[model samples]
Target: MAEIQVNEDEVQVGAETASVCPACQALLSDGTIQGKSVLYCTKCRGLLLPIANFLPLVEFLRTLRRPTGSDIQPRDNSDADRHFTCPQCGKSMTGHPYGGPGNVNIDTCESCSVIWLDRNELQRIVMAPDHYPVYSRYDSGGGLRRTN
Candidate 1:
């Protein structure tokens, strides 16, 4: 089993099962990042995450992460065209730019219901500015309430 350090206070113990990374073809180690289970590639620092956990993981990380005040770097347009085989299912993964804040490209294997994030991609998404649209509704008393 492999042990990974998440931070000063948290240490992630690897699972007994072994898997390979789809990005770099390196061994993927099981561990938790921000309390969510994930298969992490130590070589390329990529992450293989269950589709169900992706949103929750992003939300949790964004909540804990503050803006670094550094300029947001642009994502590589070519990455959106790259494809990879799913490590779990051996199927072609769909690559696309995430429709969220960070402008990061993500690869998903719908057959296996998994998402792949390259090195620093998670951090990019969390650090990107939150730009959710705000909606306003009128209450029973005609008072405007903001929803978002």
Candidate 2:
């Protein structure tokens, strides 16, 4: 995997430019997840997803039925303690538990609005028992609405 130096001011990866993986520092190849463009690391198989694509991906995953007998579990808090730098912004990424049933901790860059998810984190979230109504809280016109 080719190592690339990412600029701190770079907010997004262009289709013509390459990126580096935040986890393994490997070359990040452009890829699609659930029809949304994302960056994938060949070495660690991790995914770097822009925050804009997050809600859509979750909504799509919600449409699928959970597989029977699946026993995936979220990583411990120690996993979140590991510091990660955003490949896009070159800033420290904050780690937090994903606001859903899986209890998966994800690294997020508030400045760049990007997220880093290790392998299988997406699967655990998709198979969560309850759906995450992130976009549903907003009205069709994009205004926030109260949910009972």
Give the number of the best model, judged by lDDT: 1
Q: What is the lDDT of candidate 2?
A: 0.68
* Residue lDDT tens for model 2, 1-148: 9744432211223343257787888888776654567787766767788988977776676576455623334345768788888888889999998886666898899998888888667666766656434433545654433353
Q: What would the per-residue lDDT of candidate 1 be over residues 1-148, giving only the tens digit for each residue? A: 8754674212264763457787888888777876788887777878888989989888887777756523344566768777798888888999988888776899999998899998678877876667533435655654333443
Clashing pairs in 2: none
In model 2, the runs with Cα more than 4 Å from the true position are 1-17, 69-75, 131-148
Compared with the true structure, all predictions reach lDDT values of: 0.74, 0.68
Candidate 1 structure lDDT:
0.74
Candidate 1: deviation at residue 15, Å? 4.4
In Å, residue 53's CA in model 2 sits off its true spot by 1.1
